[model samples]
Target chain A: MFAGAAAALLVALVLALARAVLGPTVFDRVQAANTVGTLAMLLLAVIGFLTGRPDFLDLALVYGLLNVLGTFAVLKFFRYGDLGDPGEDEEHHT
Target chain B: MNTVVDILSWGFLLAGGAFCAIGALGLVRMPDFYTRMHAAGVTDTLGAGLMLFGMMLQAGLSLVTVKLIMIGLLIFFTSPSATHALARAARARGLQPLLATGKGPSKRS
Candidate 1:
């Protein structure tokens, strides 16, 4: 039964992937990416339970954090169109 | 005893799965970026919350349950913030929304 549920989620993931490939606009792709992240978190939880390890839950949590931070970073870059700010960025590096 | 919990979980997971599918379809079918964000929000909050709630039912007050709750909370909070920032960025760039007085999303991508 649980396997069946997880299988359904996999189908959803496929649909999201389709969006990522053909979304036309960058924001559409970003939306797809976010959805993918959420699904991945759920999948990790399910896998953790199924295998009885439960350790994978920790990984899922980390993945979730990365997912949000990654999205925000991408959006910031998209908005600014530059990953660095010249001397100010160089100062941080030094 | 177990039957009630089983039904609850099944209902939740199934409903959440359906919402996720619909959200993805909207991601493809919507006309533009902003509409896509609206659709995406549905999946992030409602779909994810339902699935996590179902999992919690099965989890029964454990560390896993706490983690699941955290996941749901994170999505709920961050998804809206992401959407707001995206929309604000778009608007600031002078991408006028094609709404009939804010009725629906822009009709063109």
Candidate 2:
């Protein structure tokens, strides 16, 4: 049953991959990348169970954090065309 | 027993898969960036949440299950933030929202 679901989501991931390839805009591609990140985390968890090694949850956690940070970084770069906004960020946040 | 749990997990998993597919179709079908942002928010929030919930049931309510719930919460929080940021950036870039006929922003350029 779990394998069936994992397969279904894998199909979804593949479809998203097609969209990413055909995306006409940068934002569409960015959204595709985000979907890929979320799906990767879910896939990791399922694979962990399939292998009977629950310790893989730890890897999922690390990957989830990385996915969030990586998405933020990519969006930031696309938005500002820079890794950091030295003036506006420091002033606005602090 | 595992049968009941399996039923529940499969249902949730199937629902999650449907939501993800719908979101992808939305990506292909939606008119522009802002509308796509609307679709993206729906996809990540519900789709990821359901898939994580299904996995948690299979995990049988343990520490890992708690972690799974936490991850869902994180996605719930961050997905919107990410979508909002994308929309704001799109607007900043002068990307226009798709509105129904005669429903666009009234203030003319």
Candidate 3:
């Protein structure tokens, strides 16, 4: 059963990859990348269960954290053109 | 009782996987970026949650279950925030959503 779930997740991952490749805009690609990260985390968990290595759950947890962080980072970068920009709140800093 | 648990776990995993695939298909098929984000949200929330729930059932009161819950919580909280940020960024950049205004897809500006 776990194997079946893992296979399905693999299929989903491929479809998401296609979107990332064919995405017309940068935001589309970013969204696709975020979805890919999520699917990969789920795949890690399912595969870990199938292979009898419960330790993989820990890895999944870490992947999930990194996935969201990566999404936010990318969005921030696109919005501000730099990761460290303080947005419109800070003025007269010339 | 054990058989019942097994069956439930299998069902959950199966449903979760199917939902994930369907959501991905929507991501590919949806026309607008905002609509695509709507589709992606399905996989992020429902697909991930159901799969983790199934895994927890299989783990049966172990550390594995706790870890699964943590991952679920992480996705649950962060997915919306990320999606919100994405939408805001797109809007700030003047990417208008495809709206069904009038006789065809029209921009809301």
i-RMS for every candidate (Å) is: 1.5, 1.7, 0.7
For A15-68, candidate 2 gives per-residue lDDT tens digits of 768768987778778877877777777777777877878777777778878877
Q: Per-residue lDDT for A1-94 in model 1, tens only?
A: 5576577678878988988998676766777888899888888877776677778888988998899888877767777776562322555564
Q: Name the docking class for model 1.
A: medium
lDDT (tens digit, per residue) of candidate 1 on B1-108: 899998999898778877877776777777667777778777787778888888889888899899888877777787788778778767765666645456675355
Off by over 4 Å in 3: A88-94, B103-109
TM-score on alpha carbons, each prediction: 0.85, 0.86, 0.92
As for DockQ, the candidate ahead, 1 or 3, is 3
Cα lDDT tens digits for candidate 3, B55-77: 88999998888888888988988
Give model 2 RMSD, 1 decimal.
4.0
- For model 2, what TM-score is found for chain B? 0.86
Every candidate's TM-score, chain A alone:
0.85, 0.87, 0.90
RMSD of each: 4.6, 4.0, 3.8
Which window of 10 residues has the lowest lDDT sum in candidate 1 chain A?
A85-94
Clashing pairs in 2: none
